[model samples]
Target: MSKLDSSMRCHAPVPLAASHDRNARRTLWVVILTAVMMVGEIVAGYITGSMALLADGFHMATHAGALGVTAAAYAYAKHHAESGRYSFGTGKVGDLAGFTSALILGLVAIGIGVESVVRLVHPEKVDFGDATFVAVLGLIVNIVSAILLSGDHNHGPGGDHGHAHADHDHDHAQAHGHAHHGHHHAHGHDNNMRSAYIHVLADALTSVLAIGALLAGRYLGWVWLDPAMGVVGALVIAHWSHGLLRDTAGILLDRSDAQLAGRLSAAIEGAGDVTITDLHVWPIGAGCHAAIVTVASTPILSAEVIRTRAVGIKGIRHLTIECAGPA
Candidate 1:
């Protein structure tokens, strides 16, 4: 067992993400925009006696806070990458931020649902004129915020922080002691940016719905439609929150994607007399994975030889090989 241990441990460079700085800057700008609009709406709502404006202003406050979480996560991950605090670095910070954002979104949905149900039972005299004006303003702000947060995808065909670019992949044998063979393409969505974008999208959706409900209440005398729309919007928002929650939770829990594992295995075991005794693979960052494999071979192949054949699975940024020979 001691002879099998090569005393060589290698890890991939931790991610700051391909678009981390750009996305962080954009999210910060959105936080500023949301905070400013939130204050403006709250002040105007009190002056104009518009409950719709007041509620939307508070909603924007939550979004600002959520986006702040995203920005902080990026900063922390970048700054602490070499701090050695996390076993796999702080790349997972974004997943935690996304998970927190989803929980906040769920709370917002629950609040809206409860308020809508209450309003439906005991209808209040809404200031339709003022509400319509605020709703329009909210829509404009949301559209701008959405434009700022949208399309922050990292199009780089490598793992986060430059894991397997074509030029870089050629040096894995010298660098990591294990040469990855055929695959150098690894990409994952920037989930932190995605969470922030979803917040803006959710706001835009609710604003549009509010405008429709306000118009119906103001002109068509269908005041009930206002609360009805709130209920519907809450349900839709909850669904979005649930999806984000599920994805982030899976990443945080280190749940391996089975499809990814199968692809990785096919590449490693496709040739040679290698049979894996144990394999563990899990995501360490957005589009990057860390794998530990224990293998048995009749001729007792070197770990390096096995890795030379295992290189084709795209997202495996880090690998640890333990060779079990005949004793």
Candidate 2:
């Protein structure tokens, strides 16, 4: 859509509260189920004497733990929907949790990779039967959990809180004669789903690899393959985590580090009767952003207009425009 059309005033915030109760409850249940499965897999790994299975189990444990964080964040956001402390209370919590989880995953990946390599060097006896059974079971669990979070996977991360209309100085025509078009976020569950999906997908993949290696080693006596596969799995996880962490951390710190800052500055200057004396743009949370512009002019750009222009600039969620000239 044209920037002008999309930049129109946000009619209201997304509606997230109604689904809060059900969504939170669902997240909580997933957390519990994951925890249970983690334990089960670990025990099975020991019985089967499969290092790969044990590693996969531990990975599942990490995912379960991550889900716990997701659940907690969701609950906090839901309970504090009306809190004045947050202009948008706890909405970004999921982003924070997802970012943190991704970082953790990377670390886990590195550790697993290193251990797997070591084992490969010193080939060990692994019972293929035990490991294979457990790996299959773990895969099943991952699939089920993935299905549970299907809704989240499809929607953008944000909550369905009511909408708000900021005051504006200009007399602009609405899209449909006073009607505006904008997207509403249901809740931040997408992050939760993303995190969950990552875990399950990785687990399923590593588990399959582990089963293959175990079979090959048992049948062909290629013991080194077991550890080799482990290292591969670890490296994959590490790489994935690195990207996730970097993105999340960027948002958390509200980094203004971008090549587009200059362009955005000029755009703000052109948007209204103002000389863009200064501008600061930074991310507030994942997919949400904020910018501050300093200007001097009669009937200078109102906060709403600034917001409109800023939104037109990608990644801007909230905006504050300061009029420094004569009123």
Candidate 3:
């Protein structure tokens, strides 16, 4: 009987530095723009005694803060990509940032909901003229910021390599006894960027609701609409926050992607008379995954053979295979 054991580390096929730079730059610009708008709204609200304007301004401040975190995370990840301290590199830095931002988003949602409820219970006099102008302005700013951040989401460090197999010469690499590095594969979404985009979108949504409420109250005397819209916005924000949290948390917890794992399992078992005893898969960066697999096979089958069979599975950049055979 013979046993073959092999371990391979595959770097993500796409270059991350450029993507990181792009995201960081975009986030920074948005932060600056958001901060300026936030301050303006706050100052104008105070000057004009418009509670709606003040509240929206405060909301914008939170958006700026969340975006600032995104920018910082991108910069940190880019700067530390080559640092040996990160076992899987700094790819997941964005995920961490995303997680934090999600928490902030959830809090913001709660705050909005709570404030809306309070206002609904105790309706206040809103300066429609000033508040409406600020709300419209805020909406415009949010729209512009969203556009700025709307670059190709796929063109980042976490760019997907779903087609990594198409260009991969796996057999050739095996024959040459060289490990594959930086082979492209389809990647999943960049959670960090998504989180940032969500923040901007959420803010934009609130601005729209605020505008509608202010308009309705000004003309139709539907003052309750303002708080009602806030409640709706909060619910929307909460929903997005929950989704981001779930995804980022799954990655941080090393949850396996079921679909990818299923594909990997099928690929391995199809190659030979092998039974997979154990398998573990987790994302290490955007659009990249690492896996460890244990297989039991006939005496004639070697680990190299199994490894060859598992090649071309997209997004799997690192693999460790252990093969056991009858003695």
Candidate 4:
């Protein structure tokens, strides 16, 4: 048999688990603090009878729900530290959690929009003094929450830095080859937060809009504008929700392989140390993916060889390589 390709040499092992845990912990704290604040906002809105405050409260609830998922992800990761059921560990649990949260957020957006529209049709006289006070309080809360989330390293689309950071015995070069696997977790969480952020922003905007509407309705007697503001807020949130749902559904269904194709192919071609022909890739779960490659080389390269070479390419794990026709 032909000798193993010299270019197929191994590199230092990467630390994926430890890093992953750190991020999970960070996310847990962020979500926990935000959830607590969300509950408070909901109660405040009810007591004050402020539409804008209620709207902001609704947005906070979604964030709290999303954060709950983030906490679950952290728990799963901690529990399943090393299980054969997950070939790549439970790193992608974060992504799955985020995706679920996104879907929930989208539904919440739709519900809020519908209710806002109804209230618009039958406008209520809002206590501007009370509503304004509550709205301002909500704005401060959201800003502080956002600031806390941003200060952490895990608040990104990539695991840590730009991919999943986990403690594994795998070689650094090998893990680098599949860096794409790490991104799903980050991407999912980012979507969840983004949905929450949009909701909060909309809340803030609605308050400002309501101020104008309230003044016109109370003084100028332009009642129609109040409902118009509601309609506008509903429309804006609905649009944001649609995008979040589409993206999350795509992730849940494992439909984001196209974007992964080019990157994996390039990594394999560079690392495989062999001429590449046909390379196919698909996501298996969050922060994990599988690939199949057909290469033209002197002899057939084993799956292990290709996998070792492809490890560090970003988002790749559990790779399969096959030898094609004569070189």
- TM-score of structure candidate 2: 0.73
Better of 2 and 3 by lDDT: 3
Question: How do all models score by TM-score?
Answer: 0.88, 0.73, 0.86, 0.66
lDDT of 3 by residue, 125-219 (tens): 88888777877888888889888888865532223433233122222212222255454533456778888889988888887998888899999
Of the candidates shown, which would achieve the greatest TM-score relative to the real structure?
1
- Which residue pairs clash within candidate 1? 180-311, 181-311, 183-312
Please give the ranking of all candidate structures by lDDT, highest first, separated by commas.
3, 1, 2, 4
For each candidate, the alpha-carbon lDDT, in order, equals 0.74, 0.61, 0.76, 0.55
lDDT string, candidate 1, 1-327, tens digits: 323323343444555566677778888888898899999999987997778779778888998899899889988887887775676677789889989999999999999899999999999998887778877887898888777766544421111332432111222212334343333433466767778878887888888898999899888999999999999999988988888888789889989768767876777677857787777888787677787777777776766676666565566767777776643
Between candidates 2 and 4, the one scoring higher on lDDT is: 2
User: What order do you get sorting by TM-score, best first?
Assistant: 1, 3, 2, 4
User: Mind giving the per-residue lDDT tens digits that candidate 4 earns over 173-193?
Assistant: 222222123322422134434
Query: Model 1, which residues run further than 4 Å from truth?
Result: 1-12, 153-186
C-alpha RMSD of candidate 2 = 7.8
By summed lDDT, which 10 consecutive residues of candidate 3 come out lowest?
166-175
Model 4, TM vs. native: 0.66
Candidate 3 residue 47 C-alpha distance from true site, Å? 4.3
Go through the candidates in order and give the C-alpha RMSD of each one to the true structure: 4.4, 7.8, 4.4, 7.0
